[model samples]
Target: MTRRILLFGATGYTGGLVARALLERGEVPVLVGRDRAALDRRAAEIRPSDPPYTMVLDVHDVGTLRRTISADDVIVTTVGPFHSHGRTVAEAAAEAGASYIDSAGEPPFIRWTFEKLGTRAANRGARILPGFGNEYVTGQLAGAWALERAAEMGVPHRLEIGYFSTGGSLCSLSRGTIASLAGSSLERSYTYRNGIRAERPGARSSSFRIGGRKYSGFSIGTTEHLTLPEVSPSLQELDVYLGWFGKASPLLATASLAGPLIRRLPGAKRVVSTVGARLGGFGKDGPESHERDRSGVLVSARVFSKSKHKLSEITLAGPNGYELTASLMAWAATVESHASTRSVHRRTGVLGAIQAYGLGVVRDTCLHLDVREVESAVVSA
Candidate 1:
């Protein structure tokens, strides 16, 4: 069977970028989406140098979707707030035996896939993984790499991840991302704590100084805590912190403190929905070249051994989150398309980014991004 790379939601902000990037990299992908006109226009734009193939089909049509996908194909999607619209696509992909990946950064959606669909996908011999976007992929890959480095010295037990997106004013985020926040505003998140899955009362926040610059960061909902523990056998704790909401980040703590009450209050839901709509909408384009150039993800990690020794300090610096996300997702698609059964261990059950593709592959693919690791020097406290 020939390996085919299929892309869904090709007209959206991230998906369009992914499609364009694919073309720029000399790849011709099969574009699928609900809008025939838009898909046609996008396909023409992406492949002006060549003809293109596209499918105009509603994702809600499960049978059609299933038939559209093939066992030797891979699908990368960006049409989300995934918790609501994502499951159907995932279902169809799994049913068709197509390996799947998405730009879903929401915790609820990611957890749903693992807790609810991981086994089913495994049963069908399908590989479906989520949160392969800028949200957690960077952290997951960083943590996995750090753990490997730490193991050379000693067995690592805890993985601490800090994701703080910073750009001066030109920071542009997608409407889908903002829509995701609005959809699950009051949702509580579980962090891997002391070898147990648990939730604290409020979103955790912290300050970090990397490269002589201090930044404020807070925890955001991600599936890393749930997925990482399975990959990191010796891991006793996992904390993934992010600051994507920009000025609205404090609301994470606010909701954590009184989410039930606030969610029940009048106009609160409408208010969040309205703001997210504006932030994610209003003729808003995804980050422009200048904006993307300025945009970056600064992820730092500290890995500790079970012996209470700090084993390593690692930093992963990368370019524009959305662009990088598209790059990473496209790379995964290429890798999975040609991946043989012998290369994949089905027992891991769908697998995290590091598990689905080996840590080495991820690191190598992301070589354009900087990953620096240094041995930790014990500081007497």
Candidate 2:
């Protein structure tokens, strides 16, 4: 049973890592991207026991890409600016009945995926699993853990899961993700309450401290805002806090308030990218820098119930955001390649990573790859 994987964006930082992971794991993926020289170079560098194939294909050509994909194959894509390049890949994978997975974090891109390709993919028995990367996987896992504790205690009304990262994000954090913050006023912050979504904008704010520094936080972004409701019906309030600790936290928070306005202006990416590029990089010295680029998620959740079981805080951290993302994507592809998870085929509606992959599987993958999980318990008042 030869499972041919069609990997788009193989030339990218994360994509290259994904390709390497697949080859190293004994899965021969047909790496596809626009760069032949880069792909060839990467293929030469990969120390696979055997060998992997590389192809020069533009995902924008949905027809050709789909025709090339087969039912037995799986598609792992890491190309972002997903708003510009993801749908075609998903559509092709769905039409060909190939299982599709990608690392998409922007809310709009995902919203479009659900609206346009979700049903088609499901109907064809092809699973379109999004956010298999960093955004919601860890947070969703934390949500599941909170719900389990809530059910055990009884009267589980709300769960607050805050994600604090002292990490360097991949260059994939596109203008859209930043722009999503601008639209924070579009809807009130929401969390699931007894299997229903409840909105609470006032509860969304900043000024949280993690890793010995104060970082600014905000209510924008759809990961916790959207996925928590489905992962845990008992959670009425889900607030995802990013960059909530550090001397620069307040500035980041203030910028979040102006995200919409700032993004509206021209040259936004140019300005941001130039400044970010000039920052050179977070060196190996700072702990926060260690946390960021190394790929670590700090999940501090407070579960409310009778006797309030303030469960242990958990942190999943690893080496390099892009590399971890690629590894995770590769792992997801391997899992989907096997028809063993037949239940995933029957899953029709839009699904989150935790629901689709399971917490233990995700947790273990993170761990096997040196993703550190730190835990601490707190007593209820």
Candidate 3:
């Protein structure tokens, strides 16, 4: 069956990689964007330029986008700042009866998107899976694996997810990421502790080491904390930290502290795009610099249960942060497409990619792509 996918933001960096990945996998999705010239350039690069189709329409032009994607087609949207475009795209997709997915950066945005659109999607049988990118999917999947192992051993309690990378940011972060950064007015952190969600002041001493390298990691904007309720309602506490191999610790630390302040600036939104574009790529120095982040996820959990078992570990490692993100987003679209076609009624309502796709499926795919599994183990009681 032909999977009719309407790809929004097809001309952007993440969009380009996702489109390429889709083409490589032998799928021709209808590319949609507001820029005719950029869309033309992207289409020319695809294997068969004339495979499907491309449309230049603003996402806010709900009338056009709504009618265009108003069908059973899957809507793969990479446009973000999600606070801005998320509702427009999600609402359009839901009304159109299209399965929706995107790479949202912040938790509040993810929460808002799902809360506002979740019911519509469920009612319409559409999948509104956000954070399908590196931010949450890989980490969440790894956490899921660790929790499953803990459950098997009868000691599941707390999950701590740490991301260490030899590569850089996974997907193409756009102006929206910059805007999110620029608009930050206060220092903040989210944690799920003992089955309760709480916000706290950004903590110091967020530094830790993995693989013998001293990496300084702090809580940046991520949904891992938000997803705990969905993944494991019984989770006692879930913490996610970002570790940088080298000097990035200082920049990351500064970003964490200043993010909220900068976000509140009057002109911050205008410069967010520029900052994100400049800071998007990885530095050539490798592993240490925030410029070129090497991708690695270390998930360690302390399980408190009826059994004597207490510790569980799982890691989903990969290379080429940007490339991997592109691959992941495309893969997510593929899963949603396939699931939609098969009428899989497993569950709906802001479902996670790994939960939607299953570990065996992701594990096999990772193996094929040579994304190694460094460790998947459980500490016995």
Candidate 4:
């Protein structure tokens, strides 16, 4: 059986970008989505050399989805707010023993993908990798590098990662991204403090200095909290923060302080979700191409020894999040599609980029995407 790549949600903003990136690499993925007209429009827009093939399938139809996948196929999905719509597609991929990748940033959904679906996928020979996009992959790569350098310390370490956007704003976010954030705000998040523990988004606030300027970020759950420990057992605590709010970082932290109390109120979660959705105006599209071109991404990772001394710090600078996400997802899908015939053995399970492709491959791929190491420093004993 010839292995193929299938892209689900091919008509959405991020999905279309992924399709274009794949086409640029000479691999035309079979576009899969429920909207035939939209898929046709997307295919027309990209204009691949060969007439692109498309399949109309509702993600809710689990049985049909499972039946449509093959053991040797690769599935890349961008249909998200994943806590609600992702399980079916992920489960189907796992059941069919197909390699799966998704543009998921929701912390709860990511955890579920690892803890719940991981065993099943591994048992079925499926390599499931969620949060493959800008949401966490860059941080994962930086953290992996820092951990590698910190290994010689021979003591438990704490990892701190901060995500910052130098030229983007909330206006640049897509409707799907807005909805995901709104829905995720009402869900429980976690952090790794010796072990996984429940935590609220924005519960903690910290800062990072880039280009000699300090920027504040609020804590949020990210896949790094779950995958970094597996990379190095000496990891004792992990914290991931997002500085997109810029100066409003402290305000978000103050609001999060009320999360525990608000969550206990009758119907508070529903009310908040409803208000957020309305405020986001889900029907609108994301920023225009020029706006995206104006944006850039920065991810920083710091490792600290148990004795309260900083071991090393690494920072990566990259293209806009959406653009980088498209390239990253396309690269991951291509790698997975060829894994069976490659010399290196591919592990089947929920994995980070380093676990799936190794550090050198990830570094090279990021470099190709213009995501490079902008800063690095190691402290001596």
- Judging by TM-score against the true structure, name the best candidate: 4
Alpha-carbon runs more than 4 Å astray in model 3: 48-52, 167-189, 194-208, 230-233, 244-246, 258-310, 340-346, 375-381
lDDT, residue 209, candidate 1: 61
lDDT of 1 by residue, 1-381 (tens): 437888989988899888876776666789989888898898888778665798887778888887778767788888887866798888877776678989887676777777777777777778887878767788887887778788788878887887766572423776777777776665555677755354532467765566665555566556667666766688887777665544555556565666666778887866776677677734475667787777677677778877779897677777778888888787777767677643455543556887777778777877754433422232110
**Residue runs of model 2 more than 4 Å from their true location after superposition:** 48-51, 166-204, 207-216, 262-295, 305-319, 340-349, 377-381
- Determine the C-alpha RMSD for candidate 1 after optimal superposition of all C-alphas: 3.9
Candidate that beats the other on TM-score, 2 or 4, i.e. the better one = 4
- Work out the TM-score per prediction: 0.88, 0.76, 0.81, 0.93
Over 4 Å off in model 1, which ranges?
Answer: 153-155, 168-171, 194-202, 245-252, 265-271, 281-283, 305-309, 341-348, 369-381
Best by lDDT: 4
Q: After superposition, how far is residue 174 of candidate 3 from its true place, in Å?
A: 7.5
lDDT of 2 by residue, 1-381 (tens): 546788888776567667878876768788788888978876776754444688998989867887788778888987765655788888887787777888876556665666577677777777777777656666666666666656665755556666555444433343333433333322234433443243432234554344444445554344555565665555555555555233454554554455455666777745654454333223211123234354444555555653555543344444554456667888878877766425544554356676566767766777787665553322110
lDDT computed for candidate 2 = 0.60
Worst 10 residues of 1 by lDDT: 372-381
lDDT of each: 0.72, 0.60, 0.62, 0.84
lDDT of 3 by residue, 1-381 (tens): 545778897887677778988888777778899888878778887755474588888988878777777546878887865666767888877776677888776656666665677787777666777877766677776777777777676656666676655543433234444444433323344566664353522343354344545545555445566554465566676767665334565565554565556657876655765455355433221123243243443433334453444566665666555466667878767766665444665566566666566777866776665566563332110
Ordered list by TM-score, greatest first = 4, 1, 3, 2
Q: What is the C-alpha RMSD of each candidate to the true structure, in Å?
A: 3.9, 5.5, 5.1, 3.3
> By TM-score, how accurate is candidate 4?
0.93
- Residues 89-202 of candidate 4 have per-residue lDDT tens digits of 999998888989999988889999889988988878888999999988999999998888777665648999998887777787787787787777767889999999998888
